[model samples]
Target chain A: MKQKTITQSLSWLHTWSGLLFGWVLFAIFLTGTLAVFDKEIDNWLRPEIPAHSLDSREAAQTALDYLQARHPHARTWNIGLPNERAPTLSVSTGEQRRGGGQALDPETGELLQVRETAGGGFFFRFHFTLNLPRLLGIWVVGLAAMAMLAALVSGIVIHKKFFKEFFTFRPAKGQRSWLDAHNATGVLVLPFHLMITYTGLVIFYLIYMPAASDALFGGDREALNRALRGMPEQHAGQGRQPPQEVAGPAPLTALPPLLAEAERVLGPLASLSIHNPGRGDARIEVRPLLGNRIELTKGQSMVFDGVTGKVLRAPAESRPSLLTQRVLAGMHFAQFGGYPMRWLYFVCGLASCAMIATGLVLFTVKRRRRHDGEGALGAALYTGAERINVSVVAGLALACVGLLWANRLLPFELAQRGGWEVRVFFLIWLATLLHACLRPWLRAWQEQLGLTAALCLGLPLLNVVTVNRGDYIPLEVTILVIGGLLAACAWKIGQPAPERALRVRTEVN
Target chain B: MGLAIATGLWLAYSGMIALCLGLERHYKQVWGRPPSSSRRRALRATGWLALAASFAASVAAWGWAMGPIGGLGLVSLAGLALVLVLPYQPRLAIGTAVAGWPVLALATLAG
Candidate 1:
């Protein structure tokens, strides 16, 4: 065998690593992009919550009255205050309920009987976990992320004309076009690709790489956390102590005033947790809504004596190292810079998806031309890769949009409706894989993409007919744009191959 | 804030156009002729200046902490938009950046 150059080895590494993890990364990127607007999607899925603007103080008061009337003796009362993005007050007692407690109308304290659907949280959770069991999925995703990092570095090393071909893209030339697109998107958005991949790993740093924590703290993450936060071990331990007998039960201090004070210090408050709601020793912890800054203040909160309404401790200033990690994780979370920043992240995320998709396509397009010289196994592998690419890429798009259709069409009172929606999503995805396996290659690509376009384009009509809500305008408009793009793709895929085009031209001449 | 964001995005796009056109090949691709060394030098300098100004504008729009982060995003997208458009409609790509300035100025002055 000829001695392979370093570039050739790296090129092999990039192609194989990219192919192996590319599907997972594509799924991760697509859903992560959708999760950028998770809150909006959450709203669209749950149209029962009427849109309203109200004072945070006022909203907290309503939640307080509702909780006081119903769960006065509950150990802890957690209230999720309404904001512009999520305009529904919610209340839970003791432990936090999944799906963010029960939705309460912000205007009135009436409990809204919203349909039980997965909401946009499905995308957010699936983005990282791929609907696998939490730990396994996270580990799988982490492995994929590491592979992506390796691939990106290897890709940079192998590309010969990195700077020379900075703005080069020549379309409609088949393999050359695909390679140009792959290079263009990958190089142009290189910073975002690297940042997103690196930061995504960092978000689960301790979970993925427990070596440092394991060595220093004997794998006691809570202890490590307390040390990082500069917490007195005893004081931090007290915060986690289960509800115990405190001073004789007393009337809770007025919450609106406390909310106002907390908001002043912490910016807009997301939720308030009143520990021992009716007791003299009650402590109220108010957490600031994220997006006030680039650093994710995830667990940062102001603690107040619930009876006296006096500040017990201001949100602890993050020790410097923790702040650095939080800021990096914050970039991945994208909870800063308001809507414009979110939009930029969304667009960059889509570009990242394009880069990966183009790379996958380019692999198949390159291999297709050389299949004649291949052994049976090689040909089989090539065919397998081609089918897998179609199913994973186009099929995922179909499933994602199919999820919205499920959320709308499923009967509101159906038992396990959310689970059914998820099942529907998977079913659509599986069906596309079967379709890809059965249909001819070109036909399969055209049909699946065309169906995804139809679903995406018809989403507004589906929404109008089923839910009849205008609140999904932004989500619907975005889907329409994606639909238009996919429609164009389907049309392109339906066209005759280049060799056929050449033959027709010769015939005409 | 809206004007600031618009101006910042326009400046970033114009800056990317300048940097792209600073290269002899891209300069020839659009203008159909190679530029003199001095002209290329001027274009490169102007590109860097516009990018710096775009950073300042991003700061104005998103505040000090987020400006640098958001500014990078703006510049990246501006380059992406430029590259995609350059191959198909090179003059139109540069023209939009040129035309944006007066419209932005009018919007700024109206405020």
Candidate 2:
């Protein structure tokens, strides 16, 4: 009896926790899933950047030349080498807050005419940040992740016939079908779900569990960071005198030799950062590419004197704890995996999303039969939940596809173009919410899903007309096919029930 | 390599579905009668063998570290597909299991 009560209470906890945060969790999961292909999306968005064979040395030289001409006496210079997905050299100076960067064509060193759009990077940012204020969004996402963990644990505790029901699905049985799908998807990918949520929390451990660092390092964030990363604490340009004269120091040594040396030590280099450039106290930092290693933290790096191109410091050997943390983070972010692993992650992510969606739908389906005609608060709650279900599930899908349409249709020179695309997403979602409120729940679902399907299916044609790019047509067509199938499912869902069908037939007779 | 792994995964998935249906209770729901005891035993054994073959094929395709992860992913996907298929087409599901053996053999030989 005691164990039974514990299981019952756990069941209650799982249901409530999942219901309360299901919509936000769904959005996060969908965006994060899309972010697995962020680099490909970036390439598709910037059609002007034709694919090119990456020559890291040449790319680095172009970036250095661009930065020297642009920010001759700037405090810092960062250059990102061209890679497989993004075949362009990206150079930026100053801090991220003072955003000034451009993508240079790898072949010509000329700036590409790429529109100012966030592309897949926007979804990547929204995954964690939710496009809100930085600290607030991180805290909110972290809380949701914690809630997901709780739900996952309670769900496992409550499930009795876990393995027996692994391959069970009885369609058209209403709540039973939903429950079966939820159980099957959830149990099958339970490992992946747990790993993703835990690592997501760990990624923002500083924000989520700041008390540990505060107590251990006396609230010195940098010191705490250095300790956690297992690296020596070395401030940039430490104990250096400020330059008095306006004239800059002599031209810095060429980056080719330095890059070659850094590559020799640490495989292929990803990016190079020059701090205090053109000053006597200048230093260069080189970060290695993420190449098929299961380590999560950014790859090992080397520091060198800017003028002499001599190695100053090699990366410290990470402690076991640090290495474990990095591995977890790496698995969660999937930086080490190639294309197959990435696709696998994407599919698993989709399965997780399906699990959450089915759970939410099952809650209402189970209750609707018991409360449909009851003239009580229960029915009212059911109606409200149904509306929310339609709007969140189908409506968000519509909004996402709508964002892609906005991206293609919006003028190239439109002011704040990226902001407009996000606005389109929210506006469509808001419109669907209003529509769901006004229309019958079933009708609302059909309409929104149908719209999403249409938009997804039409995206390729829109792309061809607007960008005239044939390279990405195959991918767009695949998405369209998926959308078509979703639309068919929506249509089926909107059909009348057996009882309703019998009643209509009798009336017609 | 991709084709061989895909074929191996399908064979394993079909075998899992057949094993599930070999039980008297689930067999009645699908085919309106319990399977024969001997047939049930055969089905269960076949399922285990197919899964073992799938593991070997996956390991051969990907290395030791990635093979298990890939195999797990394939199982999940196949399980989902089987669930979706079993409700409406019970006979088709069993037939798929029988057909999968030859395909698996072909994939292995080709590799």
Candidate 3:
């Protein structure tokens, strides 16, 4: 009896927790899944930047020269070498700016004329930030992740037949089928779900659980960061002396030799940062591009004296705790994986989204069979829940595809074009919510899903008419095919039920 | 390489589904009668062996860490596939498991 009560309480906890944040969680999961291909999506969105190949050393040199001319006295010069994934030389000086910094064509070192669009970056940022104020958004997402972890735990506690029903599925049985699917997907990918949620929390641990760091570092966040990143401990009076005067500008050491040496030791170079360039105190740091290694940290880097090209500091050997934390972060961000692994993550993510959606539907389906028409309040609540279900599940999908259409249809030279694209996304999403409240639940589902299908299927045609870029033709066609299939499914769903058909037939007779 | 890995995944996944179906309770639920004891034993043994072989194949294709992760996803997909097929064509589901192993073996050897 005690065990039964515990299980019942856990079940209640799971259901309520899941329902409270299901919509936001769904959006986060879907967007995060898409973000796995962020670079590819970025390529598709900006068609102006033609693809080109350039040597890493040459690209670095080009970026440095451009930065020298543009911001000669800037405190820091950070040059990102072009690679296979992102084929543009990116340079940022001084403080980091909002969105992306200036990008240059590797071949000519000229500023790129790429169209302004958020592309997949919007989804990636929205997954955690939700377009809200940075601190608030992180806190809210952290809370949701915590709730998800609690729900997963409580759900496992409540489920008695874990293994016996591992592969169970009873389709067409309404609530039973939903429960089975929820269980199957949840249990099958439980490890992934847990890892993602926990690591998501860990990524923002200093913000979420700052007590330990605060106490340890005496409320110094920078110190805490240095400790976490395993930077060399600072000593008093290390650089307290006045800046040394030099005749005109110091002749800087050649970067190509340093680049070649770093590449030989650390694989392909991703980025190089020169601090206090053209000065005796100047330091150069080179970071390698991330590869398919299981390690969380990208390969080791080398810091060189900017003037003499002498080795200053090699990459710090990460402590075990830091390495573990990095691994967790890497798993969540999927920085150490290839295309195949990314595809696998995408599929698993979709399955998780399906699991959540089915669970939400099951809640209403189970209740409608019992207390649906019991009273005025019960009926009103049922209607509201049904509306929310249709809007959140199908409507969000419609809004996403609509955003893509806005990207294609919007005038290229329009001011704040990227901002307008985001606005169109929210506008469509809000419209769906309003429509869901006004229309019958069944009609809302059918209309929204049908619209989603039409928009998705029409995207490629719109592309042909407008941008006509051959780079993303195959991907666009795939989206069109998926949209068409979804449309067919929606049409099938919109058909009258067998019982309704029989009633209509009898009335006609 | 992609094809070979995908084939191995399918073999592992189908094998897992067959193992689940080998249980007498599940068999009874599906066919409305319990399978014979000897047939049940055979099914169970074959199911376990096939699953082991699939794991080996997966590991051979991908490394240990990724192989298990990929296997988990593939198994869930196979379970879903089984759910969709069993209600309409139970025999075909069984046949998939029976035929998957040999094809997987051939592909592994060729690769």
Among all candidates shown, the one with the greatest DockQ:
1
- Deviation in angstroms for B46 in model 1? 1.5
> Which ranges in model 1 have alpha carbons more than 4 Å from their true place?
A237-245, A500-509
Candidate 1, pairs of clashing residues: none
Q: Enumerate the candidates' DockQ scores in order.
A: 0.75, 0.46, 0.41
Error of 1 at A339 (Å): 0.7
Clash pairs, model 3 backbone: none
Error of 1 at A448 (Å): 1.3
Report RMSD for candidate 1.
Answer: 2.6
Clashes of each: 0, 1, 0
Q: Model 1: per-residue lDDT, tens digit, A5-42? A: 99999999999989989989999999999999998988
What is candidate 2's lDDT per residue for A1-509, written digit by digit as tens?
Answer: 45558888888888888988887898889889888888777777777777766689888988887788878877878888877556657888765221246778777776778776767788888899888998999998999999999999998888888877767777777667889889888887887889889999988777888898888998888786677666655543332436555445755778889889988887777788887887666778888877446676474678888888888887656689877777777777876546766777888889988998998888887776567356668778777887888888888888877888888888999999988988988999899999998986667878888888888888878888998863775457668786988889778867888864553344223
Q: lDDT at A320 for candidate 1?
A: 95
Measured with C-alpha atoms, the lDDT of residue A362 in candidate 1 is 85
State which candidate has the highest TM-score: 1
